[model samples]
Target: MTQWPISDAVEEMPPGLWIRRGAPPPMFSMHRHDDVEINLVLEGQLHYLFGGEPLTIRAGEIAVFWAAQPHGLIDSRTGDMCWVHVPFSMVLSWGLPEAQTAPLLSAQPLITHAPELAARIAHTAERWGEEVGGSDPGGTADAADGPADEDGAEIALLEIQAALRRILRASSRARPEAPADGGGSVPAARLRQVSDMAQFARDHHRSALTIADVAAAVHLTPSHAMTVFRRTAGVTLGEYVTMCRVAEAQRLLLTTSMRVTEIAEAAGFGSLSSFYQHVSAACGMTPREYRRQAR
Candidate 1:
């Protein structure tokens, strides 16, 4: 275990994608990707020293991490790793339909470790293989014989997002009333800050609250605030707030008979138009549709 560097000039992730399995006993030189990274140990335990913290991920589990964080994994037990890297821009764009990506781009990160994500990942990887390999099962073929790499990559990325939606939906539904504890209170303090800000957002999302307002409460600069919020909790401050309000509205929509406008206002919407826009954007439909689906 050695220290890898962080906070470099090449901090931003570029907009391309790559996926491959690690060859056993091969430890790539210690370095970070220029994008967000997701790694799952498929067949054995993976010992990782990341962000100066010791973490050991077992088989059947997954891990999402910032591409900028210093990290490395080795197989003392099996020396094997399976991994995927997606650019931050790609992830934010992928989070929404292609037509609506501009407005949804976020300056944050996302990470998770759930066993259920594995199957979806395997499906994506298989699609990638077919889309790139051209499926001829032929012995000899040129690079052009494969499907266009760009198209194949796009399909794979979309599948990754589909899996993420399921995982995130389950997560939001099972969101703990309180934040969990770990990460040495270093991250925990920021997590608590995010929780406090979330509570505020839940109560005041429609109030024209600004990033500055939220950052002030937590003693971080607005730009810095967004980074801490996302890296710590896997969503942007704005998205987090929006998620809280919409989730509350969902609860109200399902449990009570309030009209959508009233429910929106109660959930911190300043106007029916904004409420409709946000709810529709977060989900693919209007509040009425959301409520109907909830039922």
Candidate 2:
């Protein structure tokens, strides 16, 4: 298996990596990482494949993706991936609050991950994205072109990490809180279907997807299957699977030096424009800009 893509734009902060500017979409097909990554999409839709599911990450989304596991995106509808990507190796070395890291690394595939906090991080990244992607980032009052300010950029990263911690913790508590029957005794037939849907995403996020596709995997109606997906997992089926795809795409971009177009295709992006849009929206920077800045 290919190793995760490493952003050329990483700022060495001891053992941790502060990766900015990611390679364009279609960056990597399948890969793994040495560090965990967190992404706050600031632009369009980001599709991720993880743990046998396809998760769609859209603008105004805060998601925690782990590199400890293999992941990548096969496709994206958004033009560019605009967001913040952080590696877990940095989190462990930084010695920041676990309240900051636990929630994100939790067992669940995905969660709110601190919705409000994520929103705040999104705002900061969006500001940086607009400036960084600008023709003249330096012309602005905020010092747009000269690379993100030392204070502002680091703060944004901290906030993103902290929020993930919050989300992870909150979700963990919820598992205990779940009604004894929440998981209930899922019929073996339904259980098998859910398993199959999960497998389908793991095997086929690059192909075209629809609710029907997942539902059919279990021999159920799309609506019924979606209901099952949401009940078992807190997120909707579409949301769950999209998250997986986006996770996959992000890892590929960070671990390899592949061109955005190549990454986008391998990641399963239907089109370059869509790949850029989703990757930008998810990572908070265009693929080219991500690679350039990562350097």
Q: After superposition, how far is residue 75 of candidate 1 from its true place, in Å?
A: 3.6
Per-residue alpha-carbon lDDT of candidate 1 for residues 1-295, written as tens digits (9 for 90 to 100)? 3322222111222433545554333344333444556666666676654422335777666655545443444333553455655665555444343212211122222234565566457546655644554211112222234555777656755776675555444333444532333323233344456545654554466567788888887788999888877765557888867765665565456446788878888777768887888778866788898767645
Shift in Å, residue 186, candidate 1: 25
Q: Where is the poorest 10-residue window by lDDT in model 2? A: 134-143
Top model number, TM-score: 1
Candidate 2 structure quality by residue, lDDT tens digits, 178-245: 33332234444444455457556645776777788877777889889888766554467776566656
TM-score for candidate 1: 0.45
CA shift at 188, candidate 1, in angstroms?
26
For all candidates in order, the CA lDDT equals 0.53, 0.53
